[model samples]
Target: MTAGPAEALHSWMPHSPCGAWCLPTGDALPKVSPARRALRLATLVAVVLTGPLCALTLSVLGPRGRAAVIRGWFRMVLGALGVRLRVYRPGALSLAPEERERPRDRGVLVVGNHSSWLDIVALNALQPVRMLAKAQVRHWPLIGALAARAGTFFVDRPRLSTLPATVAEVAGALRGGAAVGVFPEGTTWCGQATGRWKRAAFQAAIDAGVPARPVALRFVVDEQCTTAAGFLGEETLLTALLRTAALRGLVIEASVLPLVSPEGHDRRSMAAAAEAAVTEALGQPEAEHAVPEVAAAA
Candidate 1:
């Protein structure tokens, strides 16, 4: 028998094992004035570069080669957009005897809190980390085009059953020495704060026997948005770039916290430890009473 409308809708949106919590409503993000103007010039330049970058990649090597080229280009794009990334040095590379002896061939899982669409750009700019993205990204026309070339793994977002496979694929990529960045929040948040994290990702690291690199991204303002009260989502890429450019200074601080590995612990403790480390790094409260209780269920 055909399912009811509610069932159909329920099946369409993948409900997190961790029940949802209230989202702190935010004022629309502001796009500073001067930054808006610079955005036009910046967008034009970036668009111009994309075509040639893609062409050169295809001509020089094969499919994955094209992705590597996009990876490098992404850093340039961030600079062009005035998003400055200051990375905390890669927190200690594994040096213990067991870890040191293993050929440094496996990848690390970069678990981070999601803030804006810019978070992906920021992370991509820092290094050539591959993202296991939602399938919607693949359908976003220009974004999808670039993302595919960047070697992102596109998973069907509404299909929860696929999580197992997606995690497996990610683990395989790790085995091949490609780092994977996953936003445990599974959604974006206002630049002011991070969303509750999903702990299931700890299992990915557990299965792969890889270390989890927890990181946090924070955005600070420079100029004022057109309307002090509302955000500027309508601005084009160029516009946003110009707005940021106009800033006296636009700084994005990405602090990579301690890495958690599979040694001497269960998923629950590991997840909590990872959560505490990230919260402390972000300078946010890590109170058990505040974060979604469901997040710690794992």
Candidate 2:
């Protein structure tokens, strides 16, 4: 018998018990040492106090200079959190002849898995991007002001009526040669399993007719999956921040997966394809969220 859409995809989407909220069932996380905690606290304080000054300087630089500033800030923030970032394109050392000649100027829509707030810093460390953030982030303490100054787009998710405008803004940004980063999951999930990719962000890629780049983020501590990095459940921002700051040997590995062209597909299909790409890159079984047509095509 042939498998149904969900079942066929489920065969590939294995759950990682250690991905989210490492607890009784999954591998437990290590306790943070007092000395390390104090060190991290000092680092955070320094970054927080100096970040705005850096942003102010960034405002005066040209586009290339601004990108440099963003990358530098990302590196600084990751260092403060004690999370090392490793970024590499898959099979980059062995590119095909045809791919070698492929155009590198494609305006990108970066769609990635969302687990921790640290994802933003880790990803930006690899490449500077205009991030689409929730409206509440505009009010976040020091980072909020810096993010706005650096041109982060804010969205009001609860209001369905505002989506068209947001999509248009994202498309405009892409058309003007700006790369945008969006978390397609719409909400945080324990790193164990990625949730469905919301179709809203994909619409921007569709409208701009650009490649939707899939990025997969994996957070590890001592070479093991760490739940201490996830910002899920009832965890408040402060709680999550404190937990991440206290973590030692945290490493974020970001894999830039294959790009999904939006030429022939609608928003839902594009989202499903991007989701599958990210899941596969993360070593999870291939899965499509609520897009049966995509599964059928596969």
Candidate 3:
């Protein structure tokens, strides 16, 4: 018997091949004094504790005001974690004046490669967008509550039947003129390597008739790329947090690539184009050992 759409999708969910082995080792990994790390962690806790107040304040603000507040809060979070952010917008500037401003006028599907949890914080620091996150994140401590308040769409990866509904919800939000962010690479990887685009979220952009804005994220320490910030394999959230906090001089560079039009392109083709753009922006060739889709379940 032929399997249904959701069933077929379940058979091909994307998973990263990267594990603990991908992390930086020995002298390659930068470290801060223990006291500095503790201070950073304490600052992060204090900032997170202010989230509820921020959420309350957002209730009274207009859209633009709320966006400004959210961006400020995210920047604070990044600062507390000792991560500096640098954004490059060559693509936005390269567009015609009106075209460049169109993103603000209409809904846009923001797509990017996934590397670390910090990627979400960095993206929101740049611009407030409703993110598509795994359902597990919805149950995470304080952060989960904040994400829900920020309008995150949570997808339960293990629930095959719910895939279609999740896509529909994302498309609906896009159609309502909200910028929705999705990491087409369904799972996170070490910053040094990235996985293939899964294509499900790309379909939402096609259905909503919006352009796909491709963004690239890179983590650097001491002017060199580093994977110490990655949350993968058997790593726990606390371990990742401590690891990230212990790293000094970490910089997150976000590059906004050219917008991809959905005109005359199917979801698969659109996904491929966006993936290629991000790959080029990161200056890394596509992974030669990208685990096959069929083997993703393993």
| Candidate topping TM-score | 3
Model 2 Cα lDDT, one tens digit per residue, 225-268: 65567876555777788777766677787777667888889998
**How far does residue 203 in candidate 3 sit from its true spot (Å)?**
1.1
Ranking of all candidate structures by their TM-score, best first? 3, 2, 1
Position 125, candidate 3: lDDT: 86
Task: Show pairs that collide, candidate 3.
Answer: none
Report, for every candidate in turn, its global Cα lDDT versus the true structure.
0.56, 0.72, 0.80
Best by lDDT: 3
lDDT (C-alpha) at residue 16 in model 3: 68
TM match of model 3 to true structure: 0.89
lDDT of 3 by residue, 121-236 (tens): 88788889999987877888888899899999998776868989999999999888899999888878886777778898888989999888898888888777888888886667
* All candidates: CA RMSD (Å): 9.1, 9.6, 7.9
User: Candidate 3: what lDDT?
Assistant: 0.80
Candidate 2 wrong stretches, greater than 4 Å: 1-27, 94-106, 284-298
Candidate 1 per-residue C-alpha lDDT over 1-298 given as tens digits, one digit per residue, 9 for 90 to 100: 0112233344344222211122112334433466454664567477545755564566678646755665556666555654555555333353354532223466787777664556676676655577877776787757677667656887765567887887778777877777788877665444344556665667777777888777776654443211111112232334334434554334555666556777876667777777777777666422222221110000
Candidate 1 error regions (>4 Å): 1-71, 90-104, 222-248, 284-298
On a 0 to 1 TM-score scale, where does candidate 2 land against the true structure? 0.82
Ranking by lDDT: 3, 2, 1
